[model samples]
Target: MRLHPVVSLALTGLVALATGARAESWNSVTVSWTAPGDDGMTGVASAFDLRYSTSPITAASFGSATRWTSTPAPAAPGTTQSVTVTGLLPSTTYYFAIETADEVPNWSSISNVVSRTTSPMPDAVRPAPLTVAVTSVTDSSASLGWTAVGDDSLNGTVSSYDIRYSTSPITATSWSGATQVTGEPLPAAPGTPQSCTVRGLSREVTYFFAARAVDDAGNLSALSNVPSVTTLDSMPPGPITNLSVGFVWLGWHSSLAIRPRSAEARGR
Candidate 1:
């Protein structure tokens, strides 16, 4: 016995109502639905049509709304099927639905609709300036230290630091010529002092050093106060040993001669 047209239509509506969607992030959603029965009464669904909109989703609204199709189609009947939808706006609500179609090309009504709001995007801002100083000095290098700065409004974490130095006195207006020092490790955590050594400098030269903080988003802070440090001078050579002074008369002039003990024996 064949069922009436009205009965078959009612069953198809029930199957379509089983579909649902979930918001995964600021730009994505996951759609899922229960498989419909394989029997001709409800028909065998060979594929799924997914649609989304900022407004309430209906069969008519789907025409101009964003659309996506299920690839490889849904599995055999009674299996839970799902598909992820992406590129949606964040912090906004979106409505989604799924429509099933049989091999005979008969399309079912729109499935149950669901809505979700995505998370907001991160804030992009620069961090505050850091305080720097020279802690130690050597013949050809200097060790520097500074206090770490917090991220912009604490929206992000501190990443690293940029150290710069110059032989001339460093000031906010004259820092462009300051050479950047490399091979310095990332600064310590916020509220702590970070240290690094600058090498390959000229001995006995006075240098001005400064530093800046960087956040994870690549934001750079203002330059810190410049501290001046002078490298140590070179050591002096040893003095000669066993020296002697003698006076000699040549006519009306008297001359004094200096000689080493080892040279006196050779001269004799």
Candidate 2:
């Protein structure tokens, strides 16, 4: 007796979960399909084939399309099977289909075609070098300026900057101990000079400052070179108060003597 072919193929779900993508990545999708029936014939499906491609998927496209593992037949007809497809290009649309075959080697027609686009990949590149300089200093604060760096090939714009300072040298490894400078503009424009003032500093104390750039995707760059600046002392000097002045005429030819005394001085 001639074996019957799968008469009905349908897709049950195409849930695209974000659980598999790693940091700064979006290149995965999950697909599910309902097993087709044997049209009341006496044959049962032995396996299911899943295929995908960037273009419309057809029976002829199976040879060129990316094929997933051949899943074993479901316990019974009309059952559902699911598979998670990964490592696909981000921000790209893909077409998918399913094919069922029975023990008689008769393949069913391709299932309903479905298409889905992966989420855009997150920005993974770090920003270029950021040069920080101490533009102005005072007894209680230090004004900072920096030449902003551009994003990696401008793929993503710079979101903001993380300003850090410490009494000791500032480095990438010691960033935790450094104090963060807040209130600065978030998402400073790329390739621009940004400035900010850090307050509450100690008088006559030296501080090391550094900075790093953060992209829109929250990827941070390496720490900038440590630039040191010493705050002005601005302390008042000791006061000097004294008065002592005496002048005696040395011209004795006419027997004349003169004395005058009046002296005042102040020190700060």
**Could you tell me every candidate's TM-score relative to the true structure?**
0.49, 0.71
lDDT, candidate 2, 65-125, per-residue tens: 8887744554466566677777788888988887777766677777777888777866567
Best by lDDT: 2
lDDT of 1 at 251: 72
Q: What does the lDDT read for residue 84 in candidate 1?
A: 66
Candidate 2 residue spans exceeding 4 A from truth: 1-25, 35-44, 59-64, 70-79, 153-157, 186-191, 237-268
Off by over 4 Å in 1: 1-56, 59-122, 153-156, 171-176, 237-243, 247-268
Local distance difference test values of all predictions, in order = 0.69, 0.74
At residue 78, give the lDDT of candidate 1: 60
lDDT of 2: 0.74
Look at candidate 2 and tell me the lDDT of residue 130.
79
* lDDT tens per residue, model 1, 148-260: 77888343457877888999987778777889999978666577767889999999899999887787656678778889999998778789897999999777755988866
